[model samples]
Target: MGRRVIALKPLSKENVTSFYQWLNDPEVIRYSLSLFQKLNTEADIDFWYKGVLRDTKTLSLGIYVDEEFVGYAGISSLSSVNKSGEYYIFIGNKDFWSKGVGTEVTRQIIEIAFVEKELERLMLTVSVPNQGGVKAYKKAGFKEEGRLRNAALRDGEFHDKIIMSILKSEYKLS
Candidate 1:
């Protein structure tokens, strides 16, 4: 199998339509906090889109596979003094899920955060039941730092959340 060409680009206004669909997708929202968000239409995401574009402290980019918008990844809550930020990703396109795209996107984000952005650390939180997401982050050298018990409430039940991170000194491009 050949590697799929994956590229990250600035999240655009056009992508919001896909974003609206992804946010409403049960499968896509199952592992993330989007499950708790109530987004009714593309208009519902307007504020979010505008905020993402205006936020200087956040780097949110769309994940494009062969020129089609599939998902988005971001580094938020950036702190210059602490040299760290919170990382998150959403591979909303089911066609690309479990195809190693998440791992590649994670690697790219780590590189940008640690090398190009000159950040010292990048951290992320994931639902414990999201095995695919956990695997991708681990494959990209993020270690489990902690676990928050009953952190996410879904379907009238509580799920644990895992905190994972990677340091600049620990990163190695593969």
Candidate 2:
């Protein structure tokens, strides 16, 4: 199957409601801790939207398949260091998981980080149990760095966060 590349675009008030609706579903929240507990109210969503509009360090994108917004993604500097950036994406429409769209999306964003941004390295942190995401990252050329143990408690158990990184020289994505 050929991978359809979706260009990443800016997020705004227009689809903020759709994004909010996507997050409200429990299934969508299952693996997303960063946004799972955030901005439930309209006012709060407005505030978050304002923040996104002002931020220059992070680049966010909506992931569409067949011309529909099925997910979202972002690449942000992990620290003030500027040498490395972290990434996050969700194919929240559950029905689309395991269908290769997520992998293609990862490839697109990682390519931007390497080619356009001139970033030295790309990073990502994942809960140990999110194997599908990890596999996608590995396929896109990420190498496991290490794990932060007992990082967060979810569903009555302590899960470690797997930290992975990919250097520009190491990525054979093309």
Candidate 3:
């Protein structure tokens, strides 16, 4: 089989419902930093939409496959002084998991961060237990930089967070 095609579009109101559903799905949010919190209402989603997602410093996008919304990806915490940003992605549509969606999305977002946003470096933190995520980030050229020991509490215990990053000089579009 050939690799699947994926696209990223600016996040918008049209994808709010899908975003809300994904945010609440435990399986989808398992590895997310906000796994402990709950977005219990449309208003909560709206608050995030207006506050963080719409913030001028962040670049959020809806992930689409065959024109269907499958997930979301973006670069946040952009720093003008340092030319750096934090990256994030999640395939909310569980059907797409382990199907190279994450890798493709990572590549696309890296491209945007480097070529479009002119960022010098991009970084992210992933739960240590999320092997698939670690693998995908590695495939996208991110190198493990360090670990945030017991930084996240999940399922009644603490989980280490692995810090990964890629500098603009290291990224090469394939």
Q: Which candidate is the best by TM-score?
A: 1
Clashes of 1: 0
Candidate 1 vs 3: which has more TM-score:
1
Which is the better candidate, 2 or 3, if ranked by lDDT? Answer: 3
What does candidate 2's lDDT look like per residue over 1-174, in tens digits? Answer: 766556566665576666577666766766676556565777776677677667788887877777667777878764446667898887767777888888888888888888877788999898888888888888788999999999867667888989999998987657
Task: Please write out the lDDT profile of model 1 over residues 1-174, one tens digit for every residue.
Answer: 766799999987778778777887777788765532676566667777777788999899999998999999989999989999999888889999888778888988988898888899999999988887888788788899999999987777889999999999999866
**Model 3, 1-174: lDDT tens per residue?**
655669998776777777677777777777775731677577887777666555888888889988889977898899989999999987889989888788888988999899988999999999999998998899899999999999988777899999999999999977
Worst 10 residues of 2 by lDDT: 4-13
TM-score of each: 0.93, 0.87, 0.92
lDDT for model 3, on a 0 to 1 scale? 0.85
* CA lDDT of every candidate: 0.85, 0.77, 0.85
Residue 57 of candidate 2: its Cα lDDT?
83
**Model 2 off-target regions past 4 Å?**
1-5, 78-81
State the weakest 10-residue window (summed lDDT) of model 1. Answer: 32-41
